[model samples]
Each structure stands twice: as C-alpha cells, then as structure tokens.
Target: MPGPIWTSPAPPGNPAARRAPPAGRFRSWWNSCCKGRAEPSRHTGGIVAPERVDFYVLNQADDASRLGYACMIAAKAWRQGHRVYMQVDTPGEAEALDRMLWEYQAASFIPHARTGTPEAALSPVLIGTECAPEKWRGMLVSLTRALPEGAAECRRVADLIADSQDHRAAGRERFRAYRAMGVEPGTHEIRL
Candidate 1:
C-alpha cells in the first residue's frame, strides 16, 4: 500500500486535505477532555489549555518497522496498565496490526481486539481506523498521517512518522495543527 500523504490546511487543489471538525464540536471535545485543567507551556510563558500529543518519527522507512515500533509502544503501554488505541488509516492496516501484535515479539503477548469487536471493551488494546473515546483511552498510537478524531480525549496521543520525506512533511503539518489548537506536541526521533 502506498504511504499516506499528511498535509494540514490541505494544500490548495488537493482533494484529500482533511477538513477539521467544526469549532463548536472541537471546543466541546477539548473541554470534555481537559475538564478545565490548565496545562503549563514554556513557550507561551502561561498556562495553555490543551491535551498532550506526541509525534514519533521512526528511523526505518518500511511499513513493517513503523508498525513494529507502534506495537512495541502499545505493548509497553499495556504492560503499564494503560488502555491503548492503535489507529490506522484503513481496515487492512488494522488487521495487519492485529496479526502483528500476536507475534511481533516471541516472548511478548499484547491482548488486543479490533474496534466494534465484542472483546474490545475488555481488551487492553483496541485497533481500528477511527477513535472510540467511550471505550478506548489512555494512549493512542496513530499510524495515519492525519490526526485521528477524538485524540484530545486520550491521556496521550502518539503520531508515528515513518522515515520518508513525505511522512516527515506530513508530521510537521500535524505538529503545526496541534500547536495551533493550543496543544504542545513533543517529537520523538527513533533510531531503530
């Protein structure tokens, strides 16, 4: 499958540019997530009200490596007793990750179920192309170029950026969008 092109504010003439949710809806989502807690910001020199999001830039360029790293992160989070949501761009990617989690590491096992599955509510990890704030929480591992809906409700959001020019550019756009939304997103550069 071709990698996703991530651009925010959608470049002119690009039909795939994602339109953000309406301001009212976005504000409601943000409010519900933050619950009026003010987050401290060093750059702004004042309290900024927004949920935290993290962007991970992988050193490997292949899809397998990116998905593997995502699994690693999700496994770690699950072990830490946090519910995890692994958001992909398509159902195929979701299925691929589901298969990967079972065998990604020989000695490790991460309990996960696809969204809408009967076991998803009880599983520590839920994989899907969309977010389910009501069922999934804790950490969100986003594999898509665009920010997954309802990300603000999660305790932390991780946007994975593959080692490719297009992926990096899209990651930057996501970073900008998060910042604009008053959320400070940290970048993680993965060496492996």
Candidate 2:
C-alpha cells in the first residue's frame, strides 16, 4: 500500500530524458510537495495571526455584573457597525444575556439571537456558547473562564473577568493563554 513511485521528470529538450531515473531519485513526491509547510505550533499555532485582547477586570464579584458589562460592550460594538459575538459559558447564560439585552439599556435593546438561530445571521449581535461564525468576525465579548475556541477569528476580544478570587485566577490563566497565543492582553479595571 505504498504511494506511486515518483520518477523524476526531465525537461523536453534534455538528452537525459531517455535515461533511467537513479535510485532514491524516486523520493516521495508528497513529501517534497509538503516541504516548508508550517504547522500550527504549541502556542495556539504560535499566534498564526496575532489578536487584540483586552481583559476587563471588574471590581464586583457578582456574576451578573460581568454579564451586564458584557451587554454594554456588545451594544456599543453593535452601534459602532461592528458585528458582535457574545461567548457565554452555557446556554443558561446565553438565555440570561438575551433577556438582559432587552432590558439593560431601558429605552433601547441590542438586536441579537442565539448562535444557531437564523436570526443570528442577520443580527448585529449574537450570543452563544459556540464559536462565532465566520461572518461574525468583529469583537467577541467572552463571559467564559477559558478563551473562546473561535477567538482567533475575531480581530478584537473583550474578556470580562469578575472580581471573585476564583474568577481572578481563571482570568490570570486566560491572560497567560492569550500571551501564549502571541497576544499581550491589556487589563482594564471596571469600577461598576
């Protein structure tokens, strides 16, 4: 079950065209074809394309506060003409965010739908546990502890870190992860 024997090809005008190919001259064509191809490195493909990550570390320990802040960021991004993708920890969180999007701003609401829904394709903002779709390549507001799987696609990422000790630890881990991915994350203290 070996690949085809790769006979060396000669130029049309070369007199060597009639000569037999030498031993080892039949090297695997596949290997030569793939030579110099770079592979994804240990550091998330070694930051194949560096990303701009900003960590928003809130002063409050309440989980709801983090989500609320995420709502604000998503809304702002939507208004700025950027497609926003909200990455949550669970479907429960996605639902909660969907509800908050309607009430967070009181008079106005950020139009958004869950990841798989058809409306998500047209909406400026999308919320879900899954990775952001290829088209939704704007800012990704992450509410999860670990980095979102589709983070590499987004040009900018906003990671909300709650003030609790556990949340802080998780945030630190994510910080290191982004660094490993070739991005130096910026930290901003959120007072609200």
Candidate 3:
C-alpha cells in the first residue's frame, strides 16, 4: 500500500484558521508520533522531525555534473547510516543514475537498487523516477524539476538545482513549495 499524503496545515492568523500548531506543540506531537524510535535533535531538546529541507545550487550547468553531486550526496548520507531515496525526472535518468552510482567515485561504494527491484527493500540507497518508498523514511534527494511526493515524511530533503537561469527559476518554485509546506529550507551554493 502507498503511504499517506502529507500536507501542511494552513498558517496561523489566516481567516480559514486551518493552521498547524505552534512549533513547540508540533515538536511534541512529532515526538509522540515517533514514540520509541525518535532521534533527539541537536539544536533542540525535542525529537527530530521532518522539518529540514535543503536546496543545493550547483555551479555547473551540465546535468551530468549535477547527477555526480547527487551520487556524492547519496553516498555520504549512506555512510552516515541514513537510508536515501533519489528521485529523478524520468526512467532514463533513473537508469543512468543506477549505472553511475556504481562508478561515480573510485573509492566509494553506495549500495543501492532502483524502486520495485526485489533488493530495494534491503538497500541503503534507492533510486526511482516516481513514487517515494513507503517504509524507508530517511533523506530524500530530488534531481527532478519538481519536488518529489512524500517528501514531507523524510527527515531531510535535498533539492539539486543547476546553475542555469531556467533551472534556478524552477528551483525557486520548489523553494516556495517547501515554504508553503511550512519548511524554510536552507540553501547551499556548491562550487562543483
């Protein structure tokens, strides 16, 4: 079965009055939701939740370079003991990423499988063109133009943005989407 679709409650002070609870309340609620498996936050004394979204702006305009960085990010996250979901825009891109992950670095190995594969459930990293994994609630790395579905359930989300005008525009739109979801995503300017 598919996971639930998460949407942010409307902001406070709106006429609709459908806002989410205050941050403190939300944190407590999240802790209760995670119950025994919650990780404590480093910045806050509360439990860690799916509130952090990061936008990476790459200096290169080539898609290959962007994908290389995605591989690097995925490998790093995997080494840190975090499962990852790498969402691409198309099946061709997903296949290309699956091939590249094996040879992206000379010394690094990121154990991964594409979505729907029998091994995907056991892999530390998963790559797919559509539909986020239902059980692996970890980091999400989006190489697509739009934000991947089910990102609200991830511990963290990374949107890879190329350094072209069009790409930047699309990234901005995604940034707005994150904000709309009540997450103020951090921005990182990458030199590569």
TM-scores of the candidates in the order shown: 0.72, 0.74, 0.73
- Native-structure RMSD, model 3: 11.8
lDDT of 3: 0.76
Cα miss at 131, model 2 (Å)? 1.1
Against the true structure, candidate 2 has what lDDT? Answer: 0.76
* Predicted candidate 2 versus true structure: per-residue lDDT over 1-192, tens digit per residue: 996664647655577866847545534211221111144334455555324688999999987898899988887777666777788888898999888888888788788899878787788788889887766755778899787887766667789999898889988998998887787789999998
Comparing candidate 1 with candidate 3, which one achieves the higher lDDT?
Answer: 3
10 residues in a row with least lDDT, candidate 2: 28-37
User: Whole-model Cα lDDT per candidate?
Assistant: 0.75, 0.76, 0.76
Ordered by TM-score, highest first, the candidates read 2, 3, 1
Off by over 4 Å in 3: 1-49
How well is each residue in 1-192 modelled by candidate 3, as lDDT tens digits? 996654546544565545565445543212222212245444333534355778999999998989899998887777766777899999999999998998898886789999989999899889988757665556778998876776666667788999899899999998998777666789999996
Candidate 2: how many backbone clashes?
Answer: 0
User: Measured by C-alpha RMSD in angstroms, how accurate is candidate 1?
Assistant: 16.4
lDDT of 1 by residue, 92-122 (tens): 9998999999989898788999988899778
**Model 2, position 107: C-alpha lDDT score:** 88
